[model samples]
Target: MIWVAIAISVCLGAAGQIFMKIAMRDAGPFPGLIGVVDIARYFWGAILSWPMLAAIVSYGISYVVWLGVLSRADLTLARPMVSLGYIMVILYGFYAGERMGWERVLGIVLIMIGLFLVVRSGARV
Candidate 1:
């Protein structure tokens, strides 16, 4: 059950990142450090954006699940597990027409190996 909650948190975090990336596509360049009014307009646009809304909701639920995961698991084990989100996000980027260079592929492979080892040792502790 703890592992399941951890997975939920990681997956939702990845989804949130993806959604935010999508939303940012339409958000023109940063409003800059000009003033609060410009910043508000930029933020208000994000709030009204559907993809941004989904990202916010995803992050909200992930945070709730993460609280449960932290309560039940060791922080060392749980923190590294969050890297699983990196794998999901990379996969999503690939799916969204992004190039998957060899370096990224290698990085994903390494993360998988590390996660496997972490989980194995954590099972003993």
Candidate 2:
């Protein structure tokens, strides 16, 4: 189904973000444009890191998958559905030892609600 491909692409994107976050733990703030030396510290090491590499590949594949999706679906309908990735990444954080409070829980629930409506409505909008 088209929805299945959409879900795969969304999951790939969310997983990429999660992998990048894990790879950057303790790396501190991103270096400024003027901080060339600081940038160097994060650059090569990150490019060589397995998690970062995985994230890059994941994102690359997700983009490819999205191109296929665009050919078969309405962008307006499919774009909103992509918000499912936000919910997935937030839940990943919660389960990965990050502290999730009530507000975030509510926000996730609201995203689910909106996604549900979007699916039910099809491409009518």
Candidate 3:
């Protein structure tokens, strides 16, 4: 059950990141950091975007599930598990037409290796 919550949290976190990326895909370049009005306008646009709303909801669900996970597991174990989100986000980004350079592929490999080590270490105890 705790593992299920952990998995849900990781998936939700990744989904939230993907949705936020989608929401910002067409937002153009940032209008500099000089004006409050420009910032407000940007935020208002984000608030009205369905992808942003979905990201918010996904984060909320992830947070709730994370709370449940914390109650059942050590923070050390659970925190590393969240790194699984990086793998999911990378895959989703690839599916979304983003370029996947060698660096990113290496990063994904390292993350997978780290996750394996962490999980393996946990199993030893």
Candidate 4:
């Protein structure tokens, strides 16, 4: 039951990140630190955009869901599950525009191995 909750949080977290990236693409790079409002306004517009709006709502729900998971699970277990988000980020990056190479693939494999060990070890606790 805890594991299931953990999985949901990780997946939701990953989806949140992907949605953020989609939002950022339209939002553009962060503004120079002339005024805080400058950055805030840019983000405000992004938040209003359709893709970003959806992303915001999704992440909002995900965050609430994640809090519930955290209440039931240990930090050790919950943190490891977030590695799943990194995997999702990599895949989304490639799909969005980033180049995929052998090194990236290797890194993904390593992350998966480490995450697997973390989860396997958690099962014992």
Winning model by lDDT? 1
**lDDT (CA) for every model shown?**
0.91, 0.87, 0.88, 0.79
Q: Write the per-residue lDDT of candidate 1 for residues 20-99, one digit (tens) a residue.
A: 99888778778789999999999899778999999999999999999998888889899999999999999998989899
Candidate of highest TM-score:
3
- Candidate 3, lDDT over the whole model: 0.88
**How many clashes in each candidate?**
0, 0, 0, 0
Please list the residue runs of candidate 3 whose C-alpha ends up more than 4 Å from where it truly belongs after superposition.
Answer: 123-125
What TM-score, over all chains together, does every model reach? 0.87, 0.87, 0.89, 0.78
lDDT of 4 by residue, 16-94 (tens): 6777777788788888787988988997888888877676676787788778877877777677777887888899888
Model 3: lDDT of residue 88: 94
Sorted by lDDT (best first), the order is 1, 3, 2, 4
Candidate 2, residues 41-105, lDDT tens digits: the string is 77778767888889999999999999998999888789988899999999888889899999999
Winner of 1 and 3 under lDDT = 1
**Which parts of model 2 are misplaced by more than 4 Å?**
26-35
If both were scored by lDDT, which would come out higher, candidate 2 or candidate 4?
2
